[model samples]
Target chain A: MFQNDAFRALDRQESLRLLAKVPVGRVVYTRQALPAVLPINFSLDTDASVLLRTSPDSDLVRAIDGVVVAFEADEFDAATRSGWSVVVTGRATVVTDPDEHERLSQADPTSWMPLRDPVFVRIESEMVTGRGLRGTRGTQ
Target chain B: MFQNDAFRALDRQESLRLLAKVPVGRVVYTRQALPAVLPINFSLDTDASVLLRTSPDSDLVRAIDGVVVAFEADEFDAATRSGWSVVVTGRATVVTDPDEHERLSQADPTSWMPLRDPVFVRIESEMVTGRGLRGTRGTQ
Candidate 1:
């Protein structure tokens, strides 16, 4: 979480529910030896783990192996200038289990544009935290 | 610029403006042969250049050379369901010119947390584009 006083503590339940509802999120990974963030289509299974469908030859699939990755989804209310966001940090591993992979990619795994069958990468979150800006000043 | 109906044309002016107005943006880079995104403090200079000052020895600095980096900032107005975003795609190079470097670093590049020397990385943009989602229905 941000050290600034402006960042408010977000409600875990509400934020998690919102995150689960959304079909897409930004997957932060390391690309070409630098930090990169890309939009990913994923599903939050009953076990609270995330499933990402990506091509086996894709850079994202190759980069994330037993690495600590961050996945985030956020919504900000501009009129009120207040919003809540949730971030999940965990270890990312390629899901070799066929049955689990099928269930995760049952539908559109990505929200932006269409794609072919993507290799499934699962990020098992170790830490889940959220922050928000609330009150009058937050709406500014 | 987006191919969709909402956002058709984008230019440098709009991109620089949006880049300046937004408080948060993702700095894309390559790390461990993957793309990763990190949010950091940035200031816009009058010459349409974005300024970033980071610690000289950090992994972020070491990993930014010869890579196609993308820096993006956007704000969504929930009331109108509309907002504008600007993204700059270019290669990032470490600024070695002392006199020019001093001018940018002078713009108050201190961070909330401890970071020393403030090495500057200039993202020479190859393309500046923006997209506006106004009077829209689906997610931006």
Candidate 2:
């Protein structure tokens, strides 16, 4: 299982497909000229864009408007020490259009915090890449 | 349960304790003037530095040597919609000292891929912060 060729690079389409399945991921953005990462629950739209539901007062909403950010998600089995990780890099835009906002709000991306002026943000995928382990052998 | 003050800030020591329990996290670093995040298996040393195991030729090894980076991890429960996330911003240094290298290598951080020319990197925790939801009511 720990073969020399066990590591595999996932293509763009495959990576996006995986992203659509995972419900939680981390969004990495620049804060005060330094990198910061926050775990978020996200959904994938039909056009492969990532959607996040945040609070209006959230720092992510304030800092990430019209900014490029890296969003990443993965599924790893600690017992097998095998998993896949997908990363999407894109510009985040807050959804203000009433119709789109309503539709996304109805789609109901999970938010742990209480709903008080929920903000919807969309990240259009500019680049997608992933890596996976081919086999499982070692216990994590 | 869904109160306005549900979010609570975690102090540096509390954040480090949570990080020590998690086996995997994403490391955010600057690459070509853009933020890049990658999943890595890590362990916390006595001094609160983040330690990672990777191949010598991996990009993380090449790019993050003596570079400032952010490492983040979280544990969220989908049913209760409660979780805490911790982020550590620090400088990553490749461990080349013979004694320290051997000691870390023996510690055995989980790696899914085959171990060949394994490289150990350390990120000394310069700043650590975390946030957690105090009560669980929403479903995420």
Candidate 3:
């Protein structure tokens, strides 16, 4: 997995592993035909789908449903100049199945805020890519 | 400004101020008619333009030049459950003028890795928006 001396390319499994490590990521979607990004806490489903729980009336729910969006999560340490980022690009769809919703509710995905009527938006991990950067001292 | 009990909306000035506090952000652009996001180190120019220095032949330069892109930066504390995020939407342009490039070169924007021949991409702050999340205990 070669990229450069400083950055190492990560494969699909490694990318999904890192994606599940972070509890939050920024969701990129089209707003008014232009791109907009919002940081949201998400849970990685067993199948690698990025699941977002938010209020039913939230703007994010309206904008991202059935849309091809990108979800990115990373952890970077400026002091060490080391970090890894994973981006998942896929079509986001609202989870409307009763059984699946009940199963997810039992899993207890992390949420930043409690919503009275929470809706789940699941982003299929159709394309996953990631990279890790080595520190200046050649350590990650 | 008002958003909800958990999130507070920020004005343009405050948004830019918070945007300057972080060293890295995700750049969102369109790839093959689908949204793609890549984490990149950036510097907020004095005028609020997001400046990125990378190799001349980097894929980002080729993909984002003259295209509208979204840049997002945030600082989140999971334990505290508080953070601020700022998003800047604008068109990215490559710095081609000699005098302007000379001035920017002297400014020394932060770069994750040293590049032999660096090119500058400037994203104008055409639209800026931000939000702050209050901790569960009500402290930010």
Candidate 4:
């Protein structure tokens, strides 16, 4: 019963599943009271939270801690014009527990940047929304 | 003079140039005081503003109008592990003037969803930042 003929809305479970398939997403946060976005490598945790590993000294670590942020990932084929996008929005907190850090460091979520004393930031899966575009009405 | 070895920073002009190369990007805005992102087709205006055409009643139109939002576009090669992402932060305003609307409607910026009485939103090119990742140190 989708009103829009061009796209289909995705449920939370499907959205998280699509998110896990992508290696990177754009994180949206407030920088100096203005919106800012950066693309970073991320992983969908077992609980559906977004896990990001970055350098401890990076500004991203400082900006997102204890704040609400948005993460979005999508894959679109210009030729087929069909793709899906998933957005996860929630509060982000830095994981400081020594044991958890050790586990994550050993597991090693893929990083575009090399890791040396990395900081793990978690974005709770509080609100998830996504859409699948299959080009034209009959394409699906 | 780069602090991060994983990515190279792109200047504003270069970032704007890259923004024009893509047909789509994600727009970040505040939905009920939390961050929200949506992927949509867009074009870069001659003045570097981000132009979007969507249905007049779309939630995105209401959420971003006259507000500070972030627009991001990127291209990546999964096989080569090389890509660039550009983010534009500025105020978004709906173009209400009939003449201006007529001009844009005639030009018809690319739209993923077919346009029926589309509304034009302009995001100013106030702050632009980008990063280029060449995989590893030796790859670049």
Number of backbone-clashing residue pairs for each candidate, in the order shown: 24, 0, 0, 0
The reply for model 1, stretches above 4 Å from the true place, is A1-3, A107-110, A138-140, B1-24, B27-43, B51-71, B74-140
**Docking quality tier of candidate 1?**
incorrect
Native contacts matched by each model: 0.12, 0.54, 0.37, 0.35
Q: Clashes in model 3: which pairs?
A: none
- How high is the CA lDDT of each candidate model? 0.64, 0.82, 0.84, 0.83
Q: Per-candidate DockQ versus the true complex?
A: 0.15, 0.52, 0.42, 0.43
Residues A1-140, candidate 3: write the lDDT tens digits: 11267888899999999888877898999988898888988898889899988777888889999988999999999998899998889999999999998888878565777566677899999999999988854211
Candidate 2, residues B62-138, lDDT tens digits: the string is 88998889999988877667779999998999999999998887776666656667778999899998998665555
Off by over 4 Å in 2: A1-4, A138-140, B1-4
For candidate 1, lDDT tens digit of each residue in A31-137?
Answer: 66545565555777666667776667667777887787878766655455455567777889987788866666664343342234556788875666677655224
**In CAPRI terms, where does candidate 2 land?**
medium
Give me the displacement of residue B108 in model 1, in angstroms.
12
Better of 1 and 3 by TM-score: 3
* Distance from true location, Cα of B48 in model 4, Å: 1.8
Candidates sorted on lDDT, descending? 3, 4, 2, 1
Docking class of 3: acceptable
DockQ of 3: 0.42
TM-score of model 1's chain A: 0.81
Candidate whose lDDT is highest: 3
Q: Show what share of the native A-B interface contacts model 1 retains.
A: 0.12
